[model samples]
Target: MELSCKVNYALLALLELARHRERGKLVQIEQIAADYQIPDRYLAQLLMTLRRCGIVRSQRGAKGGYLLAREPGQITLLEVFTCLEGTWSHKQESQAASLTQAHFAIEEIWQEATMAATAVLQRYTLEDLRQKRDEGQQFNPMYYI
Candidate 1:
């Protein structure tokens, strides 16, 4: 259940785009990389993957940059995750055929966990994440000597 660095960088890039989505302005990959400290080359590759998956779009020219393909509210975390990680599948058919009762029980529990995780991912969208980030930014700690 560990999150991959690729997915994390993708999400951070997406979040930056989600923030600028309301402005209707394209954000360049270098800007996103600088903002989040992601490597420029790696971010470019991730954006390309996202573009191919229909999660983001790119524009070419002097003003060329990237933007989300759909509204932030319309893009679910599950969709982003699947785009980067590929679709989730259970144990292979060959492995399943060799399982005993104990193994079957363990597999059932694993399936349940996977389903739960999927449900959570599907429930939230990029807009939701943006809102959460905004909320966190509103808090400032006071230091008194």
Candidate 2:
């Protein structure tokens, strides 16, 4: 399936937010975009969508930015995908390149892959993700001074 630029950007943006979930404080869009190399304006749009979905909350004016609407442990990648990517509930029609038999066969593979992926993603919470990232950095080759 073809994922849209918005979906990719939103996922990257969400990962950034997830990393900062422990702070439980508003984080600026500029900071998030800079860390992920994403465009600030584009991220603002995605955050707005997430905000609407009640996944994130934003503050205005000085000392204003954004924060997760819920705790990190309560957030799941599935929810992120659902809010940003939408659910994959529709089955596509057969293309001319494939025969009728191939169409249903391809659909089965697609369904299995989607279900397995969803199951794996739903198993980890944002806090678990943060701990994993922290662990990797701790085991890096660089020795402490």
Candidate 3:
């Protein structure tokens, strides 16, 4: 599946938060931008979107910044993606199908693909992802290894 730049940015922002979750520190947007090499202006807008969705909370005044609204364990990638990118929709049958084909068949295929993706995404929480990252584990292994 193709991901929009906004979605990529959102995920990167979350990963940065996840990495720092153990410290319970609120991260400044500029810090996240600098660390991830993201543009500060762009990152600000994206962070605002995240804030509006309640995925993140912002603070004002000195020593203030942003923090995850919920525990990392309570957040799912799909929830993040959905909040940032909305639901995934398959191509319309009119775009490339036999007009005679049953609607149920097309819907079934879409549902199956959505279900498979959902299963994988649901299995991972932000903290779970952090654990995987900390372990330096790859979900897929090299055939030669």
Candidate 4:
């Protein structure tokens, strides 16, 4: 499954928020954009979408920013992907196929593929991603003096 740049940016921003979740800190869009080298305006729009979808909450005025609306462990990747990508549809299907055994077999394969993808997506949460990311980062030493 290919992910759009917007979805990737959203995931990066959420992972950053998940990293800071323990502190109950509100992370500003500019910080997220700068950290990931994404456009601030675009990230803002994505964050707004997430906010509208109830995955995130926004604070106004000075010291304002965004925060996850729920625990990172409570938010599944499926929920985030669906909120960003909407429902899945077989747009590649051109027309209805003839009701033959071969056609049914092909349909069953597609159905199983979709179900397997959904099952994998639903198996993880933002916290899981954060943990994996942290684990991977541990081996890469920082270059600060």
Give lDDT per model, in order.
0.92, 0.80, 0.81, 0.87
lDDT string, candidate 2, 20-85, tens digits:
666766789999899878899999989999999988888899999888888778888777778887
Choose 1 or 2, whichever is better by lDDT. 1
Give the candidate order by descending lDDT. Answer: 1, 4, 3, 2
Error of 2 at 67 (Å): 0.7
Candidate 4 per-residue lDDT, tens place, 1-145, comes to: 6888878999999998887779999999999999999999999999999999999999997899999999999999988989999856654344556366776687788788888888888999999998899899888977987
Q: Give me the overall lDDT of model 3.
A: 0.81
Q: Pick the candidate with the highest TM-score.
A: 1
Question: Which 10 residues in a row give candidate 2 its minimum summed lDDT?
Answer: 90-99
- Which one wins by lDDT: 2 or 4? 4
Clashes per prediction?
0, 0, 0, 0
Clashing pairs in 1: none
- The positional error of residue 45 in candidate 3, measured at the CA in angstroms, is 1.8
Between candidates 1 and 2, name the one with more favorable TM-score.
1
Task: Give me the runs in candidate 3 sitting further than 4 Å from their true place.
Answer: 91-98, 102-107, 137-145
Distance from true position, residue 123, model 1, in Å? 0.7
Clashing pairs in 3: none
Error (Å) of candidate 2 at residue 118 is 1.4
In model 4, the runs with Cα more than 4 Å from the true position are 92-104, 141-145
